[model samples]
Structures are given as structure tokens and as C-alpha cells.
Target: MSVNSFLGVFAKSPIKPMIQHMDEVNRCAEALKQFFKAVYANDWDAAETARASVVEYEQKADELKRKIRLNLPGGLFMPVERTDLLELVSQQDRIANKAKDISGLMTGRQLQIPEPLTEAFDAYLIRCLDATEKAKETIGEFDDLLETGFKGRERDLVNNFIAELDAIEADTDVLQVQLRQDLRKIETELNPVDVMFLYQIIDWVGDLADLSERVGARFELMLARV
Candidate 1:
């Protein structure tokens, strides 16, 4: 196909909406950083404001997902399978949904990271957010991938991006294990209920990284199929 024709096909494809949805998901994930800052400061009001941003972005992602599902062209030719694109969006949406769930649960409980674990928790959370950011970078490569017909340097670049995402996720896993061990040491000193919820929050935060990895895996599957 001619370059213009290729570009035209991409314009009508779900790629733009997919990128837009990831943008929203990234925003939702980012808002958590601010939310945690407020939580660390014991500032519920600021934390609530940040949580509201997470909710807003998650809602925006949801709307984009709905439109993408409803408007994905059935008869139009696409570089990837329609089902693959749909599955990708579904995976992307889960990251945002998990972000919403994390923030809502923490805010509702006014949960606080124990002072002893605060520093380690911050590191773990940042690494998890790094995974989401890396996922966004990987997804953003789709336009270039399509332009290059999913070959040559562009495909290699995407492979490198996915590799970086995988590394970030691995780092989060290690951090999660250490944080859990640290939390375990102090659990006896804390209220039993709060300790349980703290562990839950740690798991939920880890889920962010896990979900981001799933997004990378989905993209890898798309590349393989091509």
C-alpha cells in the first residue's frame, strides 16, 4: 500500500483510541503518587483531592473504552486482528480500574503506612508507577509500528521497550517481597485490622505492576501474530 493509504487506514483504526485510553490510565496511575504524598503527611483533605483525580481519570478511561468497543470498525481492514485489539483495550482498562480500586479503598479507610515502613512503601509504589509509565511508552509505539509495517527498527524498538517494562516489573516484585517482610516484622506492634488492610494495600499496589506487565504481554502477542 502507498504511504498515504497506510496512514489513512491507521487513522480509521482503533490505534488512536487505544493510545488515548492508555493516556487516561497513566494519569490515573500517576494521581496515586500525589495521593500517597498526602497520606504520608496525614493530610486527608489533600489525599481526597488526589483520589478524586484518580477517579476522574479512571472514569475518563472507562468512557474511552466504551467508545472504542462501540466504534471499532468491523468491516475495515486493520493491521492486527479485531479480537486482539479488543483484548488489548480490555487489558489496558484493567490498569485504570485497579488504580481506582486502590485509591478508593485507601481513602475510605484513611489508611496510613506505618512510619517505619513509609520509606520502603514509597519505593515500592514508585516502582509500580514506573511499570505503568513504561507500559504507556510501549503502547505509544503502535503508530510507529504500523507505519513501519511492524518490522525493522521499529519492531526492535518495541521489543526493547517491552523488555524494559519487564525489568521494571521484576524490580517491583522484589520490592514487594522486601516490603512484605518489613511489614511482617512490625505487624505485631500495629492493630490487627490495620495490619490486614496494610497487607491488602501492598498487594493492590503490586497489582498495578502486574497489570502493566499484562499490557506489555498483550502487545508482544500482537507483534508475534504479525
Candidate 2:
């Protein structure tokens, strides 16, 4: 039996998942800021606090996902589009989680960080997070963008944000290579697993930014047709 039919009286979901997704994305922004602060200050406590925030935000996003899946009454709304939105928002939350994971993983571990490179890469990380947050806020304009042409600050901001992400991605590639080379010279050993995990974290961050771009592209298409 269909869950909605089992529950009976299918009606519009009172919860605004779009708004929830916006809030979740904002939470990630704050978490990213905290993550950088923690690293700069070399304080694991701050990093832990940031991680806790990620969990709370993701929990709320997950709740919204469940609500949308069960109560959306397909065909009443843009079913396929709505499903994709939910998935994209979930991806953003996971991106935030990955940042938290990296912070925690490095926490308390004695790492030989080159002072200059450390500062530079940390700044790049913050820029990436900022771009992601802006793109996320753009996604919240689904209703307005669908009705009106992509003529709003949010849409413009997302475009610029994507450009900035492109630059950061390039810089990150350079920094990653530099850091790995430096480490190889100083450290006697490097674990493949740790290297793999670090790669995954960076890739996930990029994925978040990419998902936001996809949302913006879809919003533009929807605007053109609507």
C-alpha cells in the first residue's frame, strides 16, 4: 500500500522544505567559518563545536527530505524536479559533514604543516565554503525564479559564486600538489588511506559546488519555460 494512501487525506505539506534547505545551507556556512577559525587557532574544541552544528543542520535537512518524499503527493508538484532538489540539498549537507570530518580527523594529530602553505590552503577552503553558501541561497528562489526570469540578486550572486569556485578549484589543485610534495620530502611515510580520505573530502566539497550549479542551471531552464 502507498504510505500516503495509508495515512489518508493527502494534503499539501505545511512544512516549506525550500526554506528548510536554505536554513541548512546557512548552517553550513557558519560551520565552515568555525572550521577555519578552529584550524587557525589550533583549537580542537572549536572544531568539535562546528561538527556538532553540522550534525544538527543535517538532521533537520534529512527530516525535510523525509517529509517531502512521503507527503509531496506526486503529480501535484514538480515531482521529478522536487526529488532532484531534495537530493541536491542532501549533497550540500554532506559536503558540510565532510569539512567537519576533515577537521576532526586532523584534530590532535601532530601534523607537520608548512606555515605559509597552511595559511593559504585554509583561506582557499573558506572561499570554497562561501561560494557554496551563496549558491545554496540561490536554490531557495525556486518559486520566484520559475515565475520570473532569472532577474534577481540571488541568481546573479550564484553565477559569481560559481566563478569564484572555479578559481578556488584551480588554486586547490596547485596547493594540494605543493603540500604533498613538501610532505613527501619531510615525512618518512605517508598512508594511502589518509591520502585517499583527504582526496575524497576535497572532491565532496567540489561536488557540493557542482550540485549548486546544476540547481541554478535548472532554475534558469524552468524560468525560460515558465
lDDT of each: 0.90, 0.54
Query: Which residue ranges in model 1 land beyond 4 Å of their true spot?
Result: 1-11
Query: Model 1, 12-33: lDDT tens per residue?
Result: 7558778878988999999999
Model 2 local distance difference test score: 0.54
Residue-level lDDT of model 2, residues 1-226, one tens digit each, is 2445423433433224555555665575457666656656667777677667766766665565555566655455542355555555555555555555555555535222345446655655665565566556556555454344455775565456556555555555565566555545544455655555545545554555554555455544544442
Query: Per-residue lDDT for 215 in model 1?
Result: 99
TM-score, per-candidate, Cα-based: 0.94, 0.65
Q: Which pairs clash in model 1?
A: none
> Best candidate per lDDT, number?
1
User: Judged by TM-score, which candidate is best?
Assistant: 1
